[model samples]
Target: MADNASGDTAGDALPRERKPSNTALAKQRAHIENLMQNVDKPIELPQPGSKKPLLKPPPEIVLNVRGSSAGAGSSDFHTYRELRRKEHLRIKLMEAEAAEDAIGEEFNREREALKRQDEEKTAKNRAKRQKRNKAKQSAKKSKPAEKAALPVADE
Candidate 1:
């Protein structure tokens, strides 16, 4: 009993399961440390007077929309504004199509609901008409019998 109690205590003191260490996390930490060390060095730059300009001046820009020879030889370049305008128009077209589809679906649903309501109303009206006709026929049959009995009594 003492040995069993001691074994139980030992088992309780130790963890029931052990989790494995993640190697990916260690590799990521090492990479981050290496990047930090590499970026910690000071950078050297040339003096303003010691360095020369690397680029030349840009050429003048001229736009001709009348099929003139001024811009005839230049390569056609699509500007950012033109691209944005095209994208805007495409987005508008898509929005319009989506709106049209949604409206069409709503209209179809409403039409079906109205048709069902109309059918229900017509069924009720038919029932009322049949009841009225039956009442009128019973009244007509009773009146004819009463009239025949009165004539026989007079004779």
Candidate 2:
């Protein structure tokens, strides 16, 4: 019986006999009343959105200027100097690498040019050898024909 009484009293938290707050407060209190009524059995959510929307994000506030610490103190100066030193070293290393790459590229280009020249020279020499062989073959054929054409001397 006590449990049933508590269950009956659980939903009657707001007194209907008394008047409620006005404006947004009344709407919020009404929503709370609706929520309390459906503690176990939900019926419907508050219509037309919440009275005071709680899901809104807070405003953004900038806490510090960009690189403000760069000119702040001795520690900042040391950090700035160290960063600049590293940047300079990085640039120097990049320039050295670029120069090395250029040198290597030129070396490869020269080597390829030399190879092409050698190949062309070999090709020309091979063509000359072929021509010489063909001429020798033709001369040998003429010599045999000329001997056959001449009168054969007494054997």
Query: TM-score of every model?
Result: 0.39, 0.52
Over 69-123, each residue of candidate 1 has an lDDT whose tens digit, in order, gives 5653433454545656766766676687789899999999999999999999999
Taking the candidates one at a time, how many backbone clashes does each contain?
0, 0
Candidate 2 whole-model C-alpha lDDT, 0 to 1: 0.77
Give the number of the best model, judged by TM-score: 2
Off by over 4 Å in 1: 1-80, 145-155
- Candidate lDDT scores, in order, read 0.73, 0.77
TM-score of 1: 0.39
Q: Cα RMSD (Å) per model?
A: 19.7, 27.3
On residues 55-135, what C-alpha lDDT tens digit does candidate 2 reach at each position? Answer: 323226734345844657656677668667766766676687789899999999999999999999999999999999999
Error of 2 at 1 (Å): 99
